[model samples]
Target chain A: MPSLIWFNEDSLNPEHQMVKDYADAPKVYVFDAPYLQAQNIAKHRIQFIYEALLEIPSIQIYKGETVAVLLQLIKDLAISEVVTTETPNHMIKGWQNELQKSIDLVTYPEIFPVTDHSSPRRFSRYWRKHERSWLTV
Target chain B: MMQQLRTDLELADREAIATYLQSEFPFVEDSGELSPHVGGRTAGLVRLQSFRLEKYGKQRNFLDGEVSQLSPYVSRGCLELEELRQWALKQSRSKSVEAFVSELAWRAFFHLVYEEEGDRILKDMEKPKVPMNQHQRSLPEDIAAGTTGIPSMDTLIHMLKETGYLHNHARMYLASYVVHFRKVSWRAGADWMYSLLIDGDFASNHLSWQWVASTFSTKPYIFNRENLERYAGSLLPGDPKQGDPFNYSYEELAERLFEGAYMPEPSGRSPGQYQ
Candidate 1:
């Protein structure tokens, strides 16, 4: 259940269907930070996301900025648990450990042909055995 | 919670189990005590980034072990994909960089499918078709030992076994050989790979296998022996014969590349040699 998953306000159409689809949705928050006509901070015991953009001379610096923002998101969300897939990379792993002492975290297998998070192995097995074309949603 | 998802899946689904260990226990030097329940380390995201930016596309096929060997790290949850993406986006503006970034995306794409459809993604047919080759096939120990009489492939397989890492280019070639030339199922190849590769990830390993099997591709893949010979440069920075090679040279490669100190050799032979 997401109270607020980061959405690019300046980029995402305000009239986009997902926004209206959950217009009446509760525990949902939106951060159109770049075009904030008003403050978007919420007072919650668990998580509080603060959105900001930084000026960086290099793309690497910008990526560091993104990580910084993510760190902030984790702090704001009071995210006791983090979930993601394992790839041949490790920054998320590093951050997860940094946060593990403070919370529970797990990586949902993201490589499954289906997104259910339930049948990754079976789905992989089936595809490997049967030559199935996975549907993309 | 992840186990609950597994309970909802099937008994033999090892990939799900692998993913759970990766995401939850990701590799920390102090990752508590090792146990049957836990897989190994996942940390190596930054190192992987350095590998791609510095060498992957340019030299991955040529050199055998120069890449970061990040699979084990990622597989064990010592690394995370999103963080790698964020790091990559920040550092690179080139399409080559983007290509490396998309490779990671490819991993996500397969996972996304599994997340969406569950058991359906694993099916042989989109709608169900007659099984192509339900009977399993086994490779001889010699072939399995990378002595198939094909130098490039043998080198590729040899590297995979000895180092638990194969260059991405070599990975594709070896996979294609097993699927098309040897007439092996991609799953069988995947199983073999999973057993040997320390970094074997279901998404990258399986999906890449499918791509090689031509099940996921619009075009068939075939890697002739010549292609392998031409690209058969070592991937490691130093010789494997050096002492404690895996442990010793990785940091050197990382340092040389990250500091932009020196340009490493390109894959396989020198330009004149290949020509």
Candidate 2:
């Protein structure tokens, strides 16, 4: 089964683990126009994302409904594996949930990991768990 | 329909990106080329290399502080926080990098909150510390227009619009003026700021506003004329009396701003304390 890597807004880094491991796979990044317009995302936000997209090489960029784009591509490209990095974005999560109905979406762990352990509600507790390790390791 | 963006040119220069964006996204009005912080993995790497840990600790709080300017890349995930922390430690394990690392930790903390709470961060995590029963939920037209006539507030709004960047102090002052002085909900200010910022991250921007509004913290983050003048004195006039709006002392401002009679906390530092 061929893999199709999708770089969501949160993980646009060229050196992202998914981008690295699937270097040879077909990749795409969507602008999610509906989400942007609905959220009242300013022009500057799009400007910055375009600037970032200019960096990621060989990825197909599109503007429209995100899930529709991915679903169309899945049928058009015969994509068996859909991969992307993790994000807390409400829109992206919504699309991922929709995508899962048709395909098993692969979400890698976040790019930046403070600690492998789970975080407490407060930063103090989270820091206390790893400050010594953070300083030393 | 999902329309594919044109990739005819390499998009190597600002002119190309601007032209491409105009053609590809006609809906979003092009505001000319972005600030010097263009995105790319290579740019992110270069930005990380310029961190001044030693100076960042002390000067980071001021308007003219020595910021690494790595915010756009960091927020976009063009650069990894762990990589920067390792690089800083390699420079020197001394307390220099600790402050810089803590700033990164704040972002991480927000990220964790978003991940764990799953959209809960968008709403108030805790009840309002100060009485906000009657606070307006709308952002004033003057604020969005950047014509507040208060020099400091106006300048901050202009910075956010023109450059999509604001000094942490400037952000606090602007947020305080909106959430506290103007008596508007932090959500309104956060939405307006988040929409305009080039480095806008929901977890960071929204949560920070909640911090200022005292929705997610033990106390509200308030500032007086002295604190504002100390950090952004240049924006204000020499005569403190001329600083309309924010001309009062801390006590007076608190009395005027807060509604119900309640004891004020010193806003002491917690591990999660913003800035």
- Best candidate per DockQ, number? 2
Per-candidate iRMS values, in order, are 18.5, 2.2
* Native contacts recovered by model 2: 0.53
Candidate 1 local Cα displacement, residue B15, angstroms = 28
Off by over 4 Å in 2: A111-118, B29-33, B234-240, B260-275
Clash count per candidate: 55, 0
Per-residue error (Å), model 2, residue B219: 0.3
DockQ of each candidate's interface versus the true one? 0.03, 0.59
Kindly list the per-residue Cα lDDT of model 1 for residues B40-144, writing each as its tens digit: 221143355457565555654465434555544444334455455566567646644554455555556565554454433333313111122632466546557
lDDT by residue (B1-275, candidate 2, tens digit) is 98898655564666666666777667764556466666666877776667667787767766776777877777777777777767777876556577777777778888878777777777888999888878888899999988877766777787778777777778888888899888898888999888888778888889888888888776788777667766677654443255477666555666777853434544522221263
Q: In candidate 2, what are the lDDT values of residues A1-104, reduced to their tens digit?
A: 78899888777787788888887888898888877766667666666677777777887888889999999999998998899877777667888999999997
